[model samples]
Target chain A: MFNEKIVNPNELRHWEGRIELYWIYTSGEAGDRFFKALKDEEKFIAAKCKKCGKVYFPPRMYCEFDFSETEYVEVSGEGSVRAFTVARLDKDEKPLEKPEIYAIIDMDGTDGCMVHLLGEVEPEDVYIGMKVKPVLKERGEREGKITDILYFKPS
Target chain B: MSVGKKDISCPPEAPGTPLKDSDIKEKKVTYVEDHPDMRYAWTAGQAISRFLNELKEGKLIATKCNKCRRILFPPRIFCELCYKPIDDWVYVQDTGTVQTFSISYIDPDARPLKEPIIVAVIAVDGASKNMAFMHVLGEVEPEDVYIGMRVKAVWKPEEEREGSVTDIKYWKPMEK
Candidate 1:
């Protein structure tokens, strides 16, 4: 008994498959508070350390520096761009219809920064240190998620 | 307001407003959902490639290891038991005997289904004893399925066939 090996490359086969699954993400305590504040009040909350008095934007329950309890304080959701980049391609490497500007925004009166999309201004005009404010969705449309703030635009 | 110099003591309880799942669903809290589309491909090596191709043509194929005299279904190029290359490709009967079976009331994700499905390990005829493969069973009640029950392949129509294991739609109990 003898077996013949498949010699032609065209005769070889491969099976196609996919990761047919999804993920559910839950916002923890700090994130829940921060986003709820943004959604309900259109304001931002920072966690101020009871021990060291460091104010953390995107509020946390415990201070990162000294591991002390923190208290929430409200602030206007305004910031300045610390750094920026222009993205001509999306995550899949496909070219976008319009290039998007992304920036690290240093929040006013806090020691933290957030990376978010910048809109309503030309990418070439987006300088570092430019003052910007969050443009939130209509109150009725807000879903308490980060996208509730549509983007940051120069104020 | 600045804290006084003497005002530093570890609070007995941590400061966080615990939220329940109801809070999230009721729009009392915030969350995000993300879905990414990822895909993959697996190469069916020499033996199984031929096996799948034969299935697309509405046939069952197997490989025989002359050294161990064992017939391998869902054919493999090499025999694990004899540690040698299989000697020949052989066509096996589309009929088989059920080795074991289960009635599943839940889907793959563990969600309950309105109707149950019967799945079985079937030892294909013309293959070595115990050379069985897993497949779903149809046209039979869960109570009627038992070990050693004879079954036959139910294939999809020819034009609809893809060179995959699913080319055979399922295995059904054979007529007496």
Candidate 2:
């Protein structure tokens, strides 16, 4: 038999700790191509599966369904909004000074889409299937990251 | 048709420009870095709750199992090996022997500290053999800490007690 004791609810104890660390992400093979082209030439690249002819935006080294190696192909960084939302809160759940519009853009010439911030348009004016083009940072200030494209503006 | 293997070839691009480590260093490929801000609260259960309360009173407490006759430090309500409930709580001496130690030049975040800190696993005197817990060491040189060295807990003033493991600021060498 297990011995039990009645403890007052007020006597419960807890310890406090914090998680503190910085993370560094490396761009893999397909990521390397996509980022490099954006930084150097302001170009957008997609992965094309040679066997199934499926095009993937935000390219990966291999096709997810067929497990076949993919080749990089250039595509216009313009698409239509498939869906969108307005975010009024920060990461900490505090309201932001200005609300931000985010959308899933279905990239042209590829069977893939990317989620990024939509700008240069009002939230009330944004509509599904609205055509959009990427607004990249200035050439000299470009970094090999997704932020290289500041936001998507109506085109 | 069984799906096993199929011959597939990727489309060829212009020869050259293979990604390598040099590309990263030369800023050919870019990446992102982020630090997450997070905090957590862990509940100290029945056994540790009492142990911490005893620490606030400047005393060390342990639990004893009648079946194995072993005193467990960082006290637990149940005996893991014997599969029986601990019979009673017992007082242990504040003094312990160093089982192993390390001289750490970096803090928990991997950042270099101004002065290196010495940390050790100390086996308490009244507990079962090889039963130890981690604590920082002080009032001694890094080179002087060794296995089986006697040490005593250096408690903070009673008025400053917070019922936490840190109630004992650090352990110091106990003069025999």
Candidate 3:
């Protein structure tokens, strides 16, 4: 028999567990460059690994393999959608207004791709191996930022 | 009385010795998931939360180490040095400069924001390599903010303040 209750607990009304959090703050230069590439005609850019001559499409600052200084190279934003998923849930797993087609586009001259939103088509129509190109934003005063290119649609 | 020129007030008088650990209370937040925002809120210790809540009051406070003459922001009451309990308090200035910074086109929910948010790693007036503070930048062109650039707070109105870092509103460039 328990003396009253050793560790008697509620049915657990909410989330209970242990976790670690990493609070990350990023630099402005890297961030501006990232969005700029996305805005300007979807030209994919990769940071060249100064060591092994390998290029990273997602654009890493230091070489993953050798920690060497990397440089940026704008690659052809045109490519086939390598892999993708339909995002039915928000970042917190809550449902979204309208679903989005998230895809990885493998650009020419780069080893990998730039993941972005694919629009202008029904969700069911999106498929693996779809060929697409970046839809650049209109001309005027582009601060060379992202969203300069609107959204990636059938192109 | 002067630490140096440049209008910085005389170095604050150093406090002597640390309080014995017998003074601290044993308390912590209930760490859990399924918040309206975070999948979970990481449970932090009593000292840490006290530091954060103080920020809500629009005050900058850090734990002081009487043993090593060090001040820690995001205040921890235990001295990482000397292996002693920190047990003291020191208020910090809101002024700081960009140590390193980045702008994000996404919000806390990871959704694309209508306008990009300017976030930065501002090294406050008194701290070390790991002591850079995280906050928002405003009133200056995103292009103008750079590494090592100086900035100060554009505090939220006193009446509206709730004692959080957000009460400062954003950091603005200190014109040279």
Sorted by lDDT (best first), the order is 2, 1, 3
Which of 2 and 3 is the better model by DockQ? 2
The digit string of per-residue lDDT tens for model 1 on B101-137 reads: 9999999999998989898999999999889899999
Q: Residue by residue across A12-104, what tens digits does model 3's lDDT show?
A: 122345454544222234344555555544556677876677877767666666556678888766777788889999999999999988888
For model 2, chain A alone compared with the true chain A gives a TM-score of 0.87
Report residue B137 deviation for candidate 2 (angstroms). 25
| Candidate 3 structure quality by residue, lDDT tens digits, B87-176 | 577787888888888889999999998878799988887654467778999887778879988999888877887655678889998985
* Model 2 CA deviation exceeding 4 Å by range: A1-20, B1-23, B37-51, B54-176
Q: For every candidate, what is the interface RMSD in angstroms?
A: 6.2, 5.8, 16.9
TM-score: which candidate is best? 2
True lDDT of residue B106, candidate 3: 93
Clashes of 3: 12
Q: Write the per-residue lDDT of candidate 2 for residues A6-51, one digit (tens) a residue.
A: 3543455876789998876778768888998999999999999877
Report how closely model 3 matches the true complex, as a DockQ value.
0.01
Write model 2 residue lDDT over B1-176, tens digit each, in one string.
Answer: 86976665443543444667676567655667789888776777788889999999999999999999999998998999899889999999999999999999999999999989999999999999978899999999898889989999999999999898899999999873
